[model samples]
Target chain A: MREAIILPTLSDTMETGRLVQWLKQVGDSVKKGDVLAEVETDKAVMDVEAFHDGYLAGPLSQADSDIPVGTVIGYISDSPEQAHEDQGSIPEKTTVAKGMPVGKTTTKELNQRDTSPVATAKQAVPDTDTSVPVSSQQSGIKASPYARGLARELGIELHQVSTASDGIIHAPQVLSAALAGPVPNLDAGPAYRYKLFTTMHKAVANNMIATLSTPTFRVSARLSFTPLKDLAHEQQQSVTLLLARACALCVQKHPHFNAVYTPRAMAMREQVDVGIAVDIPGGLVTPVLRDAARRPLDELNDDWRILRDKVKRNRLGPDDYQGATFYLSNLGVFEQVTHFDAIVPPGAAAILSLGAEQDGKVEFTLSCDHRVVFGADAARFLATLSQLLDNPKDSLCDAAKDQ
Target chain B: MVEQVYYWQALNRALDIELAADESVIVLGEDVGLFGGSYRVTDGLYAKYGEWRLRDTPISEGSFTGLAVGAAMVGLRPVVELMTINFALLALDPIINMAAKVPFMSGGQFPMPLVVRMPGGVAKQLAAQHSQRLEQTLMNVPGLRIAVPATPQDAYWQLRQAIRSDEPIIILEHELLYFSKGPLEVGLEAPPMHRAQVRREGTDLSIVTYSGMLDVSLRAAEQLTEKGIEAEVIDLRSLRPIDWDTCSASLEKTHRLLVVEEDSRFAGAGAEIAAGLTERCFFNLDAAPQRVAALELPIPFNASLEAASIPRIADIIAAAEKLCSP
Candidate 1:
């Protein structure tokens, strides 16, 4: 049997993944678990593994094209002849480069199995033929691929559909709107451009929206960074690394500060795994430093260096960025930024934001999940962290010696 | 209106109630009389019922089960408690061939009114032999009805119903759910003996499960709800005569089906349900039916491996999400 190689969801935040490159081409015999292609999700570029042993077949989705997760990009068959037979069934013209103008290929032109909106939307992108007006041919409504497919099948204008949730219309919403008589022309009077969200940006937007729903309060502290700066210079460690170390030490003293608040229970983590926010090209990523308080400063620096390289290369695994009890976002490297509060990720109880040093003092803003940490607990944690940063040499060297 | 009780206590209460209500009711199994059975399901029953009714048998499942069948034939309602479902294999011939067929073979002269109670499923590191789930095997038998009760309430009523039924029935219990507590209505009519119950109602998908898998499915449903997917959970109280009506009704509304079972995937109970539902509710389905079952391998002794081997909350959630996905 010929197995369709649907693009698997690489991450929770990934709705669609851009095919970066194909590792195996047509006529290539591939084994299960072999890297078939590299897909760039919002979080990272991941290798899509072959789930079956067969010769790779085409009418494959083009490289550098964004394919919705779960859409069939290609196939793998028992033999090259079988692969050719399968490819013959798939419309060759439907396999167009993403972002290029899609010609007029309706339901008849699509593969019977790939008749989803994701596949339809890829087919619906207007070609560069000037005869058809872009406005009439393309109603750029922010809707899911499945919704778009259903709208096309029903001959319902996407722009006229009313969504109950965020402006993005999903299939269920589209179905409901279609059921409730004729949809009103909601797209009139406004000439707004439909902006496509990158997977990473969408994740960040979703997280920020979710964080707003949580009961949170920010506590800012101005700490004298002269001691930490001097200690960092003497120890040849980065100030951000030193601050993370201090935060880790503070978490050890007050375990509640290193806790996650779910509706079920408050999980107090014994290990002070601190996630340090690193600014990547597209968005921010927090690579975790496991057992940060216990590890020596030099060892922590070594780990940080490796993680920084991985982040730069877009090779950080899920483990590298997930399960941080506490988060640290230091904007101290940028000279102009004075102080800014950081959004605490969903699972973590608190995030520590460090501002640029001015007059030998750095502003530290602690945003906590009020459900897990009370004002007093955050205050106590910040106070301990401040104290630790005030005398970094004595505390860090003493902790290292004790370890 | 109702009081909470542990799963084992509910079984004990049902046995106590049935023994007091009927003179012919008797309990027989290894350690059932003296030590109160392996998981203490028959705890304190020996003292109240005395040695005649609450008689303990030696370590011979086939002989004891055969004796229970014989007792049932001669106008006694015998409830035979096996230490675990793993040991029930020793008496499969008696259970399937004799106890299940005696009524039909004898031309309705004798009805096998017997209830075989046994705990099954992986608990801690019971290893391969001890952690077997043979509900699928027992369910395949023609005359034997299978009941897997997940909660204290179901355990209480279903056991009584099984004991009352003239047909031979197997009560498959989870050893891990022995201590879990739920409400048991004191004076209410027992639920139907051959129907499934919708534990949690939703519209996005139906998670059909029973036994300990019901808990896992409910937890998975809760997790799915957090992601905007409402999953209806169906607990198959009766496994043999599957309540296809309840399942089909839920599938008609949800249009998606995910069968979860702790038994191994191939030809397991979930496969049977999936196959049956696919046949009946083919037009109602929006997606192909998916199943989350224990991997097709022996349950390992290691804690982590054992945990990995069985269908878990995360596995159910993943399977349901895939089934619901467009």
Candidate 2:
């Protein structure tokens, strides 16, 4: 049986991938797990491997043509003979140029894919050429060679343009209407505009937009401690990590402060995964520590450093950044900052804003969802947090102390 | 001890002094010959220091400018004359690509001890083709030092200091000032090349300029003083590696700046100075920095039109008056 192979959602962030270079051509036999073609995603060039064994078929979108994701990049069959028969369906002129197809594909286009069996089958199955002409003209539009060539060059649809008075498509009209100018000649170089955005930027945008939905209330106060500076030197860990440990221990005592609130369910959670807001080059990222209330101080130090480095390199996958119960945004590095309020991230109930260190004292602001956690509960959490910070070693276990 | 000379002649004296003081120095360019260069900056040097040391070449500005880089790479200090900076358009490949970049790119294995001199800025009715002020254009490239000296004393001292440094330096001179006479002081003295000089001290406001406009700015400051304005004049002798410390220090005292230039107002070197001042002394500023510059229209060929094309002393005085107003 001929099995249709459609594009699968690769990473949680990927929208579409370009068919860079097809390793297997029409009529070539493929097997399960065989690398069929290379696809270029925004982040990196990746290999698209086959899920089922089959003979490759044609009328396959030409190698360089950009099609929507799940639009039958290629097909697989139960037998090599069937794959050979499928080759007749693809356009003869469709072949990869250089190494890959050159075009941009964003993630928003990939989200529109319909995963139903019927839609996938219709996309993957190749249609017979005997039913209709393979050229762009069979759709009932007569365009001259020059007009057709100009349309392809500009990436314009010939169907959208009217026929010229001389019964031939005018290049100037096509260019003026489609490109907003006289059509650039085929010999002219392709016009390109560059846009630069890293994976870290996309992640930051998503988190900020998600965070705005929560009705966050900011509560600020100054927490004085002379021992923190000396303890930080003794442990060789940043004051930020020590503060995180203090918050984690405090969350364990007052679970309401650490819990997440769901508006739909009208419920609060019990687990604590503290989101430590690390400032990356492009923007900020909050990588969470699972069960931070249970982890030792030294473990938190090691984990925070590793996560911050991952954020800078844009190597943090979705799992590394997700599942936060609360966040800690420390601005103690910038001396001018007295206090600042931050938005609470979605799926998290609260965020704690840490201000600049002044006169050997640390100022903090705890902003939370008032619907789930009360003002008194927040005060109790801060008191417990202060106590843990006073002697962090007493709060952390022996094994964690070694990290 | 008290002789006087043209600003360009003083520049040649400084070059000769540096070449004699250092064995690594050599001169390269078109018509910098026994005929002595188009502006005669290197007049008699060809006979004293033979063909190899004082080399004259074909009109290929790009290739010969590249040759200066190649020569500098092998421990030779080359001073390349672009004849007129209008011709520098041909030599940007070497000036920006090789001469400026070779040091950082090669990880400090070699130092580019090269000085490129070009008689720049609009000169009277030399027409649009011959007259152009692009010191600002050269200032945009990183790893290059730009020096635009106004006085003969600066012409001598800055030229001497530029030859001693390990970096590539582009010394821009106004073409009309080659014949202008000034007092000559030929010692190993004066301020560092990157520092701006306060030509005249006053309390009311500051008028900033460099190169040809420095004279105009000083004249403007003098005219404003009679009207009881007391405008302080600052000559921004160095553009790149800008003397921000001096400008900011002045702004702290004066609270206003009227930058005058022969270049067009849009994206001029004055903009960079204004931006730097804003960054360093934003709160100290009483009024926005005012710029007196050439009109956006092309440099016209007629004498009256050419005069209108550049910022005059009247323009500088008017701008300073506006800045000083309450």
Candidate 3:
């Protein structure tokens, strides 16, 4: 018995994933919970796990190939013989038996059935089962015209396609049914294939395009982060975490920078949820540190560490990155980067960008939505942020003094 | 201003208004006059109009129904109430052959301005014979116009429209909906009988239904919404002179149609609707037209079996999910 391993949805927004590489080759033993392959979704590259113990089956989707969510990329079988027999077999339309090959029907049988297209064509018409060949009509097969057309084009028999209710074969049902069968080697010829945007990529693209529509302005200033860097090192914290804490403290004093500007009105949020921009393999993601101004420095550091780990693992839930009143993008860690401004992420009024430290000073750029914070307000917020960073011993530890 | 009323009260109010306005209108059926109708749809009509106008006849659907057709042959507008639509089989000869055909056979010289009000649907364990839905049987007749109202507003306005029209009409009401409450806009003009209302708008698929199935379909639509599939629900208020335009417009957008009905699957209302939609919108349809109808068996007397026989909310959701699944 062989089972088709489908590409599962990793995220709420993920529609399709690119099979980056297969961890196991055909005839390899697979155990439950073992990572079978690496799939690149919209947000990040994730592992495709084997849900059942079986041997890896061949005719797998080629690496670097994109498949829709819920598509069977490959098959897993109980034994090597079954795995080999299941290789290149089309997936069943209905739910397949666990660890069992969909059916014993081979691609050769489908080809033989496909040669008689006229017999299947007669079955496509409504209320005329007699028009079909006596044997085919006796079987009482039901399939949509589009499904029949695709089955004929693919040289697959309509009977091989599984249906859920009413036994009517649809085009998608036919396509998936065909996938379980011998997959054509189309990737061999095309050196360069178009990769469809993952859901996260599409969302980022759309957000960036929408951000371009907002009336935004940038203000740059040099900050002496020597004290903050020392304090962060003493606290066993990264400079980005300290910067986020400083922004949270600064946002409490300068509420305008923590407000979101919409077409209707500017909303000033009560909590200073600062979003820390982190670069992953494919793109950038901002995992939010909620209520940074209210939480203790130690707790904030712990949360930031956990968030980073989650982003690396692509396990950030909706709450992990959503709802940020302010954003922080620090490119200071990168040796080549000096100073760069980031487009304000949606829902945030402003984003603070920090460049690499040159000497005892680092250039900070604040991009503000002009509707929410004017040039003067942005300057004041940046100045407050600079003051907090310059004296982290007072601001960073002040919140914990009350405790 | 909108006023909330029970489904039967709306029909009662429509009857009260029509009986007060017209002197030539008469009400006749078993338990209709003295009993204020088995469902109380004609509750106060008998007291207000008296025995002359509201005449209670024997339990003979065939004889009383034929008498209404004879009354319509002259100038009187007769409103015949059948206690349940299941018993309408006894009156089918007069309804289909005479009342429905009189105006056409008379070459428009005489118009059969008759309204047959009956409640049809599965209610508890009403047994096989009593709980049958026979609107599909009447829909097959060409000369008659059918109006099946799912809401109180439709019940109020559609019944009034049926009484006013100079043609024979059958207003099918759900047995369960008689007591269900909904807002009825008092003075609002009735929508055209041929246009089906899009009760809920969605982009994925259209769940075309009427009568009690409208409520069932709406519940199914809610479940579909939770599954991230937005299903558009079209309530076919008028079954005969079937609302093709509204159905086609919805199908043009959704490209998938799931006709749901409480009738049996074979030669049922949904089958006709599904076939009709396929014929009109073959190129627009992305998938084959599907129907969620009652199982092809007598509605059982057992509560669980009866519930299983008819199209339930889960069955409708399953059908919609399959149609929109890709």
Candidate 4:
């Protein structure tokens, strides 16, 4: 017995998932609850786990390509021999059984039925038998006039164009099929291959474009970071964690800084949740610390430790990284970054960027959505933050608690 | 410059304007001079223009319509009124043989400045006899022209345009649209009477309809917007000389076509639209052209069945959604 493995929907708005890599090879033994591969969604990389205990089968969908949701990525078979079937059939052929479901027509019979795509399409007409299935979901494929023309021009076969559109192929499906263009007849130019963009890269680009409508202004100042650095070293705590905790405290003191501007009214947030940016393999993510201002220092450190571990393994989910009242991005490790400005993400009033320490001072640039907070409010917020950073013994008490 | 008026009032205003302007223009039909026409389209013209210009005759469609055909053959421009299109069936002989072919058979010697006005489509419980839409019969004739105006503004513009033109024109008005009100700017410039108008612009599909089906198609297009299907509504104001250019241009962008009609499905107006567009826009289409028309059976006398027999707003929406579902 064999069960098909389909791509699962990871988010509310997700339409497709990119397969990053497969953890198990064909013919390899696999058990239930085992992660068979890693698939990347718009937000993060997620695990595609096996629900059935069997050997991973062949004809697995390739990696580094986006597959629509509910697509058959691979199969799990009960025997190794079944799992080792050659990868000759494309994904579309597997969707249709090639011939009419009449006493199991063989590949040789299907081959003899047609020498051209037009001929094969005509062969879908039922024979003189009375037992043909009533409305076999895919007994026939009907391509629109425009789609057929597109396929002909692009040198793609109609059967190879797969769509979720009942039994018809429209122009959109044909255009997507043409996405993998044939080798360019660049008869005079050098050979080059096109690589599609990953979901994470596209998500980041779209997120940046969304913030372009917000009116923003940046305020910069050199803050004393040596005291916080010494406090972190002496107490054995992460600098980024302490930074996130300090930003959360500052946000709590300046409630106006936590408000996001909306058309109806300015929304003042209740709890202080700080999102700290972390670099991942292909892109970056901002894992959030929920209730950072109200939670105890030891709990905050433990949450930060878990978030750091997830970032290391690239397994951040939406709950772990979304809807923060304030944001902290620390580039102090990249000593070359100094006095850089960041855009204020939607749903947040401001983002604070920290640069590497030079002459015992660190550059802190606060980028704010001007609709929520003014220049004076930003200046006051910065003054409060600098005062806390200068006197770390009084401010770093809970953040320095044992993790 | 724009005033809201009922469809019947728009027709009355057009007739009043033309009668006061031209002495050669005369009206002859039953009850038009004394009773002011069935749907009140010729209201008050009896008192203003008197019986000579707005003359009412007995209930003899064949003889009266043939009399207008002869009057148009000479110098006078005749505009004949049949209370409903069902009665026009008795006058098809003079309409098909005389009014449509005289100018051509005479080598352009006699200009057929004739306009025949009638109300059509199912209305209330008019039953099957009175509620007939035999446009396919009139449209099959070559020299004849059909103008199906949906709104009061178009009703005003097209009736005047049909009266001034030399060709034989049939102004087929819907029985239900007589009281339907729309803005009428009598002074505003009008497009060529036969040019199809795009009521709404969309990219998903094109809905080609005329007369009674125009308003229904527009409402269906509005509802389809909420379902994520943007449908373009094209009012084929003139059916015989269908403006294929406008429909073909829409198909160039949308790639899908849906024809809506109040007539039957077999060889009706929608059939010609789908077949004609298929021939011209075969490569541009993204799906087979579809139609939303009345059932092939005779329209039932029951009210609910009568309503169900023809294409409603919901029917057009469902057909459009299916075409663009891909």
Task: Give the top-scoring candidate (TM-score).
Answer: 4
Q: What TM-score does each of the candidates earn? A: 0.50, 0.45, 0.59, 0.65
lDDT, model 2, position A133: 50
lDDT of each: 0.83, 0.74, 0.83, 0.84
Clash pairs detected, candidate 1:
none
Please provide, for model 3 over A1-403, each residue's C-alpha lDDT reduced to its tens digit, 9 standing for 90 to 100: 7788998887554555756667788888999988898776543556788999989996687665556678778888889887776455343332233443322435563444322211222211222323556446524666665566677788776554666344466666777777666544332342222235676788788788678767899999998989998997887887788888888888888988888977788887999999988888778788999988888888888998899889988998889988989999998887677799989988988899988988888999999888888999888988887878778888888865654
Please identify model 1 stretches exceeding 4 Å from their true place.
A1-403
Worst 10 residues of 2 chain B by lDDT: B279-288
lDDT of 4: 0.84
In candidate 2, what are the lDDT values of residues B12-130, reduced to their tens digit? Answer: 89878877788788889998877788888887888887788788989999999999999898999999999899899999999998888999899999899999999888887888978
Residue B233 in candidate 3, Cα distance off native in Å = 6.4
Q: Specify the poorest-scoring 10-residue window by lDDT in model 1 chain B.
A: B280-289
Taking all chains together, the TM-score of candidate 4 against the true structure is: 0.65
Q: Residue A192 in candidate 4 has what lDDT?
A: 25
DockQ comparisons of all candidates to the true complex: 0.03, 0.00, 0.20, 0.54
Tens digits of per-residue lDDT for model 1 on B221-289? Answer: 999999899999999988999999999999878878899999998988988999999899875665668
DockQ of 3: 0.20
Choose 1 or 3, whichever is better by TM-score.
3
The TM-score that candidate 3 achieves is 0.59
